[model samples]
Target: MDNNKLIEYLETFGALTSKDKLCLIDNVEFKAYKAGDVFLHTGKIANQVGFIIEGVFRYFFYDGQGNEITSYFMSENQFVTNITSFNEYTFSSGTIAAETDCLVLIIDRKGWELFAEQIENWNSIISKITSKTLLEKTNFQRRLINQDAKASYLSLLEQNPSIINRVPQTHIASFLGITKFSLSRIRNQIANK
Candidate 1:
């Protein structure tokens, strides 16, 4: 992972000195995963936060019927974590699985705290990330509640076109809170129109 890119991303939220960037990079560990690998399993306590360097991953939950419901997708340059588990040191309700071969930069909770202490500007960056993530999740849930399957799928496509091509159709259906058949029908209808 290029530490410069990561630092540049952070710079979008606030200015970070080269020394601060180096300090943050020192704590990050690079990891790779196969397409089917599970990065975070449900009910497991996750101590690390991952920054995707390449490929995609899905954060999901299993329903009572043993069906997977994808809550979100993280692509390259994005971050992934079972936030509640990481924050509270409790079991996570969701799992994060690789959708493709992935490379990530991971930092454990301790590393995060150490960096936070060293970088004064990082507090603002962290707050922005937290608020943005919360808003995105809230808006997604609201859309799911108010929109039909087709509308939800269209909205998702409009928002994340790369996901439509990169993620599996079945997973996309789950993410949109629809059955595969429903998704197929929606796709067909969109194609016909």
Candidate 2:
């Protein structure tokens, strides 16, 4: 991962001093994952948080029936982790899996704490990130409760067209809380219209 790109990405959140930027850079460790790899698993302690340097990952939950429900996708320049697990040092209830080959910048909880202690501006940045994640999750849950599968699929398509091509249709369907057959029919209907 290019350090310049990572610095540029961080700059978007807020302006940082040279010292602050260097401190941020010191905490990050780059990692790569192959397609079909599980970046995180449910019921495991999540020790690290990741910033996507490239590619995509799906965050999901599996039901007792072995059905998957995708919560969201994290792509280039996005941060992701099981928040509860990351913050509380508890087991995760959701899994994050690589949807494609990926490059990520990982910071362990200790690294994050060290950075937070040293960077005065980091608290505000962290708050903004958490707020946005919460808002997105809430909005998604609202949409799922109020809209049909077709509507949900359309929403996902509108927001992340790249995911339609990068992720499997079955996974997309699961994300939208619909059966594969239903999603196929919906896609066909939309295509014909």
Candidate 3:
């Protein structure tokens, strides 16, 4: 696992002892998905959590009117999982698909349980991860509730400029809770200014 990007990324959260590293090395698996692959589809039970070593993905769901509503987009060094389904062992409410050829480090439920049991200070790492996720969700919700489309789009540009280039315009529009036409107008407005 010397060249594994997942292990390298995990080290950012906390330093894993030699023993802890070995435990993770033994359990984590590497997987690759092609661009446009729907690795985890809606209504499926999400059993594995993964770290994006190289790729971009979006969490999307079909709204009642049969339109795709993208909730979030994630890129390299990020964790992408349907947390609600993974935690509850229920059907996933959305789909997670790669936007480009991607590599990920996956830890299954059993592997995660073993890692937690064997690794010291593992709970601290998990707690930090949980805290970050919560904060992001809270901020996103607050923005959606308080900010209009143009402000939300501008916020996205400020916070995640890379996403505008990696993801399609339509997906970005959906994530911003705006129409593609509206997104185009916003872009033109910004460009002219």
| Stretches of model 1 off by over 4 angstroms after superposition | none
Local distance difference test scores for all models: 0.87, 0.84, 0.85
* lDDT (tens digit, per residue) of candidate 1 on 79-182: 88888898899999989999999999998889988988999898899788888878987997798789999888888888778779888899998888778999
lDDT of 2 at 4: 69
**How does each model score on TM-score?**
0.94, 0.92, 0.91
Name the top lDDT candidate: 1
All models, RMSD in angstroms: 1.4, 1.6, 1.8
TM-score of 2: 0.92
Q: Compute the lDDT of residue 107 as modeled in candidate 1.
A: 87
The CA-based lDDT of model 2 is what? 0.84
User: What is the C-alpha lDDT profile of model 2 across 111-149, one tens digit per residue?
Assistant: 899878988778788887788778987887798789988
Better of 1 and 2 by TM-score: 1
lDDT of 3 by residue, 27-110 (tens): 888889898988689999999988888888999999889999998888887888888898799999899999888888888999
